[model samples]
Target: MGSVGVAELRRSLDGLLTYLEPHWDFVNCHMVNYLTDDHWQHFVPEPLRLELNTAKDLNQAIDTLFWRSNRQSQQFPAFASFLAAGDHLRLENYEKLLTTVEQLEQQLATSTHTQLSIKEFMSAKKCHEVELTAALIDKLVQSKSTPNSTSFIVDAGDGKGYLSSRLALQYGHRVLGIDANTTNTENALSRNRKLQRAWNGLTERAELQSQGIIPARRGKKSNQQDASIIPPSLENYKTTSRFITTELNLSDLLTEHFDQQSNNICLTGLHTCGNLASTCLQVFHAQDNCRILCNVGCCYHLLREHFSQQEFFGNKALMDQQVDCGFPLSCYLQERKVRLGRNARMLAAQSIERTLAAKELPNITLYYRALLELLVCRHAPHLKNELQVGKVKKFDSFPEYVKKCADKLNVPWLATVEEEELLLLLEKHEIDRQYLELFYLLRMSFAPVLESVILLDRLLYLKELGYEHSYLIDLFDAVISPRHYAIVAIKQ
Candidate 1:
């Protein structure tokens, strides 16, 4: 494996792939109740509870579980053995192997940090992604492939143009925001107008605030530009959702936009969902114009799995596509035909750091969902698999919930379920709910392991294609942005 660039991902890929295989079935399979499905028992260990006989006891134990969960990071006390001794320790316990962020940035070609002159008006997560992305864009624009002044930025799946607006307005790069929906494009354009209008005096506000002075008095009018004052970003940006109805050719789009030179465009996507993220990689390889790529993807369950064990829902063409559906894109997994099911992909999107930091536990809603599934099995056996009892908190009692569900599903039989039968079912599973809650937490431990495999595979693909400048940067604070890892690449 080449150690200097993209090949560095290989150092941890083998171990991660190994850990991802055995747990694939556990993570991907649909959650079946531990009471009903005996097979699931093996996956969930028996917990030593504080006697969940009463409502208070059950609630307390559940709270304790959350307390423990929120305190967890990629590693925990119970996982010490597995994390240290497991075959994939390099990735499963990434805190040890990935080294420091400073080291990683050196290899990724992160440019020197210059204090941003403009004010940042976004959520912490959005701000982190933008700052990190801007840093990478700096390196790419100054790359030897083309003149830095002529290079442009293309934001794929730009939702409300948070990153695009900042890149264009703050960074002064000509940016085009592309979305699959016209509504998003319109909303982004409108928001950009508002941001531009508010752009005046933002720097002064930052400077004054740093020195502990109030920037302005809220209700007092000051010398400011009109709301319609268009900024350089608004003038440079054009957004449309027409791509939803048409095939996208980045090379053609960039060529048309700039007559300066081909291969001088930087393609970026923030939280691009499903195949769109994978498609970003494909675009990098297919178009020479797309010389730099910074992609962070989410909603793994939405990706179509080309491998045999892949999920069978959403976008029929994705399943039928000639290329792989975002899973195991690297030759390593491709050769083994490693398949991660839909559930596993969903699990991969989870954040252990966030959960631990907030003392967050599995929601009571999930417990209700599973318990409702049991009620369906008993009261309405025929409609058990057919009915989905979603969000029943509005009802005060079990019978009211059942009746409400019956109305939604149009099943008269559910309405006929006796109050006594409902009470009996809830009472019986009372303690089991706590057990299930603990089980859910335990299963979540495998989250980072699975995510590492998917990410490393993407990196390996770029390396195999002979682009050595590729690197995976640990971009954001995990608690702020769960999907914080970004795949960055630049052509030689």
Candidate 2:
């Protein structure tokens, strides 16, 4: 389970695709289309549906199966045979196919790595991500066979410069933060300036806390002096607003910014969105100067798939303009024509652990939306699936939800419908609410399985490229940061 090699990764991908192929329709189906499409009847097996209906407490049973079973090895008495009944329902089989966080951490041996104190300026989650990712980048830098003392870091999609600022101000690495938006670049520079001013006091306070000592409050003048104590050499971080792509040359960009020729460049990103993550990998391989890569990607929903026929939620026109799609980075997937629809990729981003920890479920709006689809089909059959009834404000009842949605969609005829009719509609379909909730949970159980496919595809891409030093490190708490896995590689 430790750092999986090329052969093992290929086998895992093949097995995952095999298992997912039969259930693609389930994974790809939208919740909005649930009632109209007869999803419950089509997707849920009769035995499973009967078990759910006959359970003493369906909610408790679902909670036990989804959360307690995975966390504490506890299963609902009624649903004990759920997993054994079918391969699709078995969590153990999915677990067997995935490379776990523990295994990835063991492979990297990152638990013992010392981290810098920088919690004062970021959230607990961001603090965790930055500290771990920055530490890994430093380790990769030091591990280089031809380690250059002047090796610089290139932080792609560097929003507000959190990681780049830490790498420069604390770790003393020359860093260039690149982002797409101009406002982001300006804000990152401003944030870095403020961080520089506060670095000394922050570090001193962190050290005192570590040693179990509480320092007395200081005056404004004393704090100002502490802020001024930052060394001149530590101000090596720079940022630019430029859209990143595979064809972009890192070496040329470096020379343009720092006015120095550098061949040893470490390309890193913290939760780079959509195509940018794959773009970073492609840039790393395309540019000789990009000797190292450490990237943690998020927003799988925005990824453009070459083989997918469905339109994604993001800018489809812009996505079509791009040369390389985000998914299936490896030739193995490309050759097989692998495709993960937008809905399935979006599901991959969900965090089951966090949901379990909070004892959360899908909002009632999902049920309301599904119910509204029924009305849409009955009245406006042509607009079915075409209506963009986005998020409506909180409503106390089903009629209120319909009114709000109708107003938003500018369908006056829908709003003019009698309140009694809406109430009757709600009464008729009241039983479907619990069924929809069960469907939501059942689909969410596949989140990690889908995520594993995307991550393994990226890892296998590196393997296919003959990168012997590449590794996938699970670098953060999954509940705190769901997209916690980082793809790291070093050019030999």
Candidate 3:
């Protein structure tokens, strides 16, 4: 009916709602298609286009929400440019976008003041075990089939026992935090000592506050002490404990601490790498007394061999003989190119200045390899063999970079024609710098989904093991920390 600018259009559309739309055809066609192509690619299959063509009232509602009256006659393009984004519009993945944006904005705001503070870049949640321990305690308290007071927590692959300390000090729960790193176990003990001192101060302060000796807020007038001096539940208190061992020996360590016949124990982890989470799942299933488990798996590829199902390096096997892998490095690289293309525009504006600041531009291949590394964990392995085994000069241009790569791989010099041929291929793939900015939003949307698959595996494993209340919840910012989802399970 009328023209609406990008600003108004964004205000009207909720991104996440668009994702969760119940009408499969509407979502998969109109919204999903527009996203992949920015409504520009006419090459879209007729079946796909027809899917969006709803003639009923349901179709009308979908069209009004997305196409809108203002966009009624703009002759939307059939193909989108790379990373076709439509602002921060009514996307189905709104909550994640909001959280990541909030954290990033806050971090950016404080950046100028703290040039060297990595903590500013960290998420709002505790990097250590305090938050997780609190969550576990809440779950335990709510369970009708709560285990005996002697029940313990097994922190599998526990690096520095962050959660272990919280469980012991706050909830008064005994915990055994295990890890392969000797230094990590030692540091955990050291940190727990420091945590213990700090906790003592907090307890004393809490007591005073409870007795009306202190104020809850800064400079607030108060007649009585604040209740925060003594948190009603150890829910706020933190614990400290440590146990160190290798992956192969974890099962033995768990068996030593937990009795299979009588003890009611819970196995848990936070960001346990590669096969560590898998090991936890196996241990949970194998141990009868280990009744409740909460695990969040990471490093899907490293769990085991996809086909042969070779046990690369874990005590327990979690994967089937076949690895359910998707998205070869090719798709990830394409998406990344789409992302970097937008960022390159900003760099293009300050190209001279940035080039000067760095004192050298990286070789084109090196830059390409770095971007590709972000998509898939592996890097281009042949480049090093092909290029001169020497330190790369920052001043090298794209051609110079290619020449180095060719020389390192022992290939003959690339003619200008050959170089251009390669560059053209990159452009065709939309791997150029122009697509980076917009693709970040889409990438942000996928972060949670990617992580969900990993976390879901752990929940499913727990469920299959007879722990019915096992659930995966969004406990932290998905964008700010894609690995922020938590796997929480209750003992029945």
Who wins the TM-score comparison?
2
Q: Regarding TM-score, does 1 or 3 come out ahead?
A: 1
lDDT of 2 by residue, 1-492 (tens): 434577877888877777677789998899999888999899865766665544345676666676565333243433455343333423235453344445544555543444556587789999999888887787676655254445889999999999998888767788999998899999998887777767777777777877778865744656345443544454588888888887778778878888988878999999998878988899999888889999999988888887987574647655665677988899989999999999999998888768877777789999989888888888889988888777788799988998898888889878887889888988888777877877888777678778888988998898889887677766788889988888888787
Backbone Cα, N, C clashes tallied per candidate = 3, 0, 50
List residue ranges in candidate 2 displaced over 4 A: 1-3, 54-57, 70-114, 145-149, 215-228, 231-234, 316-321
Better of 1 and 3 by lDDT: 1
> Candidate 1, after superposition: displacement of residue 425 in Å?
0.9
Please write out the lDDT profile of model 3 over residues 1-492, one tens digit for every residue: 112222322333223224323322221222212222332234233432333332342234223322342233222222121113322232233342122322323322322211111111114445423454345443553342344534667777667666676566655665667766677777777766666645645555556665667624434425564535643233322222333222234344444554332366677777666556655666665666666666654454443322222222232443332233211112222232211121121221122212323333334443444332222222334442222334445534555655554465454533232556545545554522322212222223223323332343344445445564555444544333334545555555
Q: What is the C-alpha lDDT of each candidate?
A: 0.67, 0.78, 0.41
Question: What is the lDDT, from 0 to 100, of the residue 379 in candidate 1?
Answer: 67
Regions of candidate 3 where Cα sits further than 4 Å from its true position: 1-129, 141-149, 202-262, 308-431, 436-447, 464-466
Q: Candidate 1 lDDT (Cα, whole model)? A: 0.67
- Clashing residue pairs for model 2: none
- Which ten-residue region of model 1 has the weakest summed lDDT? 69-78
- Residue-level lDDT of model 1, residues 9-63, one tens digit each, is 6667766666656666667655544455542355532232223345565455445
Best by lDDT: 2
